[model samples]
Target: MSGVVVDVRGLAPVQRFINRLANPDLRALADSLGAELESQTRRRIAEEKTAPDGSPWAPWSAVHAATRHAGHSLLQGDGDLLDSVTYQVSGTQIRWGSPLVYAGVMREGASQGQFGTTRRGGPIPWGDIPGREFLGLSAENEDDLVGITEDWLQELMP
Candidate 1:
C-alpha cells in the first residue's frame, strides 16, 4: 500500500551528520521515527480515512464485495488493511507499507477503465475511484511527527 516519508533535511548539520553516523544508538532515531509513522498510519487506516483531510475511502467495488459474500460495507471491513500495515528503518530511511494486494488500489483509487466484459457481455468501464490518503499526514499529524522526531533527536545530544 501507500506509505509516508519524513524529510530530515531540515535538521541542523551536526544532528544530521549524527543521523548518518555508523553507530547503533544513532540508528534508534530512525527506528523511533519509523515507529511513530507506523503507529499513526495504523490509526488512520483503522479510521478508514486520510489523516490530513478526513476524506472518506471508496467502499469496496461491487464485484469484490459480492465475491467475498460480504455486504458492501464489509469489504476491507475486517481490518485486514490495518493489520497488514508495517514499517521498516534502514539507516536514515524509514518506510511503511501494507502487504494487502488491494491496498494500493484502495489508497490510490482506480480510474474509469474498460474491463473485458460486463455480465451483459458489454465492456465494463470502472468509474473514477477517489484516493484516500490514509498513509498521508494531516497538518497536525505532521507537526506531531516532526515534534516527536525533534524531541528524540534532542535526547541524543550531549
Candidate 2:
C-alpha cells in the first residue's frame, strides 16, 4: 500500500498485454493482487510477527509487557488492528491499509510524548514504543505479486 507504483500501460513487456485489457480485466487483476497482499498482511500479524523483510519485531518493553493480559501479544490487543486490515479496488488501483487512526503511528512508531501530553499532563504514549512493522512489501511479497499478475495475464491469453 505504501510502496512502489506500477504503470502497466507504459512498460514494454506487459505494455501490449496490458493494453489488451478492458477496465474490467484490469479491475480483476487488481483484486487478485489485493487479495494476495491482504493474506500476507494477515499472516504477518497472526503468524510471522515480523517485519515484512523478515526481521523480528522489537520486543515489548518490560513495563508494557507486564500490563498485557496473559494471552495477548504485541499489537494483538482485542484483535482490532488485525481485524481492521482491509483492501479496496477502485478502477485499476488497489489500495489497502487500516482505516484506524492510530495505524500510522503503530507502523512507524512514535516517540514518547511526541504528540504532546494528556489533560492529566502525562506523556501521550505513556512510554516509548518501538516500531513493530506489520504492513509492507518484502521481496517475497513483490515476487508473489508478480506471480499473481503473470497468472492473471495467462488467464487472459487467447
Leading candidate by lDDT: 2
Which window of 10 residues has the lowest lDDT sum in candidate 2?
15-24
Give the clashing pairs for model 1: 52-138
Model 1's C-alpha root-mean-square deviation from the true structure amounts to 13.3
lDDT of 2: 0.85
Model 1, 1-158: lDDT tens digits are: 89998786776776855764535375677777778787888877655555357666666566655667442242247777877888887878888878787777667666665345677765444455556666767777778878977887667664
lDDT of 1: 0.68
lDDT per residue for candidate 2 within 1-158, as digits (tens), equals 69998776556756555566653378888888998888999889878889988999898988888889977887788889889999999988888888999888888999999899999999999888788899899899999999998988787654
- All-Cα superposition RMSD per candidate: 13.3, 11.8
TM-score (C-alpha, index-matched) for candidate 1: 0.62
Can you tell me which runs of candidate 2 are displaced by over 4 Å? 1-24
